[model samples]
Target: MGRSLVRHPGVRGCYTAGNKRFLQLNELDELRMDVYENVKLYKEWTKQWHDSKITRKEIIVGDKVLLFNSRFQLFPRNLRSRWSGPFEVVTVFPYGSFELKNNKGECLKVNGHRVKYFYEGQPIQARGELELEDLPSLWDE
Candidate 1:
């Protein structure tokens, strides 16, 4: 009698390659899991480092500040000044909003991120004192 090519002893099993492929697939899955864990760890470490370097800024009411002006009619030129105001802070909301008063007594509400503290001895000119005729006459068409 010819010996049967049985995989399981005494039970005549077919030679299906499923078991070998299953072991290879399991090994691949474990390798992928390891890579995912490493990426997660790297992201956490970077977040910690970035947070540690940031210093919180606190602004109180009555502090003098300069507002950053980003609005320009055309493409911005490097020579043009962008910082506009030595405005006094009238109110600072718990959320980052500020009420500012200029020398002309005009009040404006702007985001706190656009403002910075005005230090002493800075040369902020007195533009409020100038009359309409002293500057360009817009109505002379």
Candidate 2:
């Protein structure tokens, strides 16, 4: 009689509950897989965007460049500049490396990423000079 009651159509069976639990577990697994794929795609997009923003430095042998000063100094001043050199590029190596010559004739090999091209000054524009006699004086009025 008990077996018959358990197997009755109106009564909730153990096998039915087990089947529902198994289905729920499968749904959770599918959702987890989807999240993993989305995270991977996001990482790939971030890497691509970062790579696009990077500018390639074209360094030549004779160009003047400033080297980054990365050395740790004690009691560093707040207004001090971090770049140390207006060094001349003596040689450019194959893979983003450079040989630099300082003003004291000291040669140092450093990575190209640490150096930037230095601009001395802008070209001076020529204009006609005006004398004080040709200028209008506000005091005369």
Candidate 2 structure, TM-score to reference? 0.71
List model 2 lDDT by residue over 1-141, tens digit each. Answer: 122222447666644555667668879999999999999999999999999999999889899999998888899998989998799999999999999999999999998888999988888999999899998999999
Question: Which candidate wins on TM-score?
Answer: 2
- For candidate 2, what's the RMSD? 7.5
Q: Which runs in model 1 stand beyond 4 Å of their true positions?
A: 1-21, 72-74, 122-141
Tens digits of per-residue lDDT for model 1 on 1-141? 343333755656444366656657879999999999999999999999999997766778888999999686677878977888899999888788999999999999999789888886877787756686688777887
**Clash pairs detected, candidate 1:** none
Clashing pairs for predicted structure model 2, backbone only? none
